[model samples]
Target: MATEFEMKEIKSGDPEAARHSSMAAPQKSVTVKFENLNYSVSIKAKKTVTEKVILNNVSGMFKPGKFTAIMGNSGSGKTSLLNAGAVKGGKISGDLIINGEKMDTKFMKKMSAFVMQDDVILGTMTVREAITMSALLRLPPEIPKSEKLDRVDEIISMLRLDKAQNTVIGSTRVKGVSGGERKRTGNLIIFKIPAMAMEMVTNPSIILLDEPTSGLDSFTAYSVCTTLSDLAEQGRTVVATIHQPSSDIFLIFDDLLLLSEGRVAYYGPSSAVIDYFTKIDYPFPDYVNPADFIFMHILNNSEEAKQADKKKDALNKVLLEWDNSENKKVMLNTPATQKGLPADVMKVNASFYEQFRFLLTRAGKNVWRNALMVRARLGQAVFLGILLGLVYRDVSSRPLKSQTQALGIFLASVFEDVQVALFLAPMLIMPMMVFSGFLINNNNIPVYFNWIKYLSPIKYGFTAAAKNEFQGLVMTDQFGSLTGEKVLDDLAFTDELPVDQNLYVLLSMFIILIGMAYMALWRATKKVV
Candidate 1:
């Protein structure tokens, strides 16, 4: 019952394919086996909190040269199970082994390429640029640039993306590559069988995908599955959580692991699924797709009180049957081996300097391409500078009238700029500006409110600006004339912080604030689970 798309030429013997082919020699294989895996999270409601189990004692095996599909109804722990196996977060209790060796999540993350359901692609870059950048950053630094470029070209050809290789991987704001093409641009770490073929550079032994065909047409989904099949054929152990797939799509999978209520309903070869279910008295109807038939029986769709009970009973029965099956014993009893695969080999090959250079170049390109945003920021800076200058004008000529005004302008400018750059609200920034000792003299201000001035960067800038303008000038009121020293005493500027001291404090504040801002930006950009 294979469709035309399913039977289309697989390009298995192409030069690009041959380069990745495992048939030439028996490539190193990875076998992932999990036993008694349980995942849970604490949930709070009103005044009470409880633990919700996501995966309950789930056990299975994923072997190289096979495509294993994990499928379930909504809220059936499909994503949680995938995350438990591939990601290191949440509370998980399990025995996860790779190649008969107990492997930690960190080690697994390096050895496996996890293609998330969502496309994590740089929208600005063309298809070729995105893939090439990933290759440069990920492929061993020891490899020559030419060889890397050749690898990228080979991947581009292998994935059949030559037609749109130069097209931008656009965002919602901009039109770029087609949806199918975007789906191919997956995460860099793990082997994702997307159109970009980014993981081929690493030749990872294990590839894990979450809903690889969730947002594609039947034909595109079939093509994606075919690509995964080809990768599996080359000795990669491919595991993906698939949604309701078409009959042709189902045929592509070598093994199936179906879940119900966080418990395994079935796990076996795709070909034996119909027969297995029939033996359990859940016979398939005539001319119905096996995937659809299985979903209809396992998933709870009934709203009727009586039918709901029947569905629950049927699901429980299936779970109990799986618990008693011989397959469960075989999967849980797999022995651990002494394979020594160093976790460092899976670590990013580029040195820290190389990584920094690559990131800096990419960031520069992104900023340069967004010309409108850069120009707008520059315009704002110029306007603010001009405004500050105008407000602080004539400080020397009219020292008495403009000295305090200049101090206020400098303080406000420095404080406001820092606040805006840090994304602080005006409501929060206004209080700091008011307490900076510009409008209210620090000595005259109440004792309790005076401490706010100590924390203000504006205080340093104001003192520095006032001393620079009025240090040696003469100040006069209508009644009398006063020396700059007298004026400094009147404003409490002659006490502890001199002009040089104020300037140094302001410089320190600037450096500290800028460093904090950079750290915030770095954390924001870093990937967190």
Candidate 2:
């Protein structure tokens, strides 16, 4: 019986594999490289703000299948380099080669995934639900539903996140998924690279994380880096921008690309970086981390260093030359760095309809499972209705004096009820639902939607309440008594069933309120949170 790894090897072999068992199989490697990369953001001020360069003449290459860390001082171009790959906005100039092909920004976006420093996961989605929607919407336009599920399961297994797969990303109100799970969820969605799941994750070509360990505990950070190191060994290109990493975490990096004020101060294997720094006249003191030492050197900016234009120019030139060298390009060699998913994994006929169904399915499951704080919302709406009903149950016998007074009370009560309905409906429910839907779908609504008023539960509730109270009330009697008997005809008691109508109206309003609440929430959360 063949082992799983052996099976994978046999199945992954090319068509010629069956014909020549003794033939030497050609080795695969990542041909990813970069040249003359530059990114600069504009500082627009009311009165021409001074220009500050973020990334200056930055050029570097990332070897495939290596755990590479881009480190620098606060303003160092570490993140800017990652951003220059895609989505990050700025004037950019450079050649990025992936798989021996010059990478355009658009193509790079498809080939790479960029993770930001902040957590962008929505609150209403469960861990599994979030990853599933991502797989549906992001996977190349050709993969099938069955394959997408398989891929999601693969990612869950790869990240060791199966434990929290079903947990909602709850907020402060309730305990929810852990930060690591949330981060992994974001990664699975943003980066649609399928081969990443089966491969060990050290240096990943498909995944580029910005400050992966920032703000995490030491143990967690080290664990993340350890997993990343494993990925690198599997021949994936994993590039990350890290700041002030712990010593234990620091040990995990295979390579370090250190920058100071947009200049490459060090670019080599992590073990050699400290000795290289010492040779360059910037020795690390005892107990001082090499990462921190490099950062401090760039941020020092002493009067002598600042004033010596010649030294600065020379440093800049060395940095530029080192960055443009050919050895850096050779470092990216990894077996699976350029090996994409098999044709079976990458589909061409994946349609918007199918993707939509997956999104819809994931969203529906989340709603049905009540995994999205829905119970709390449903409970809140019911509680609000009961509370408001009990608070303002009977306003039928209130005085109505002048026409102005009647208008005031009527407007106050109806509008107040409308406001309450609108407030609770959109407020309690909108953020989570809006968060859920818009989190995946890019659909937009007009700013001034007249139809929205028709859809408002507050409008329905307010109107229903008004109809019950004043559908047949004597407008004149409600005010002061009129001087003529003709007014009495209008005020005279009629055969109308006011009490029953009030009861029906109240019930209708209550039902409509419930329906509207559900509808708004339903539309909002009908996607990954």
Q: Tell me the lDDT of candidate 1.
A: 0.73
Tens digit of per-residue lDDT, candidate 2, span 1-529: 1111111122221323122112111123344566656677778899885556776655566765678999876777887787666544656666666666666554454445566665545556777766666666665554467876776775676566778888886555545777765655553223222222222111123557778777677766665666666555555567888988866666667778877677666677787766654554546676655566555553344348455775566456546555655545554443224543212322343476977777677667556555446888798789767865655554343334333333433344454455454666656444333322122221243445434433433333333443454544443444554332222123231222344554565567678877998898766543212
The lowest-lDDT stretch of 10 consecutive residues in candidate 2 is 1-10
For model 1, what is the alpha-carbon lDDT of residue 477?
A: 67
**How well is each residue in 1-529 modelled by candidate 1, as lDDT tens digits?**
3211232233323324324433221236678888889999779899998999999999998877889999888888987887777754557898878877786666675677667766667677788888888778887878898988887787776666789899987776546899887787653323222323666666677787888887888877777788788788777789888879887778778889999889898887777777767777777776577778778776564557667877888878888988998877875675533255544555557787888998888888766666566898899889877877777665544445765566455656574467454677777666667777666777888888887787776777777766766778776667667676766677788874887887788788779978998898777533232
Model 1, C-alpha of 107: deviation from truth (Å): 1.8
Residue 340 shift from truth in candidate 2, angstroms: 12
Q: For every model shown, what is its TM-score relative to the native structure?
A: 0.84, 0.59
Q: What TM-score number comes out for model 1? A: 0.84
Reference-based lDDT, residue 155, model 1 = 70
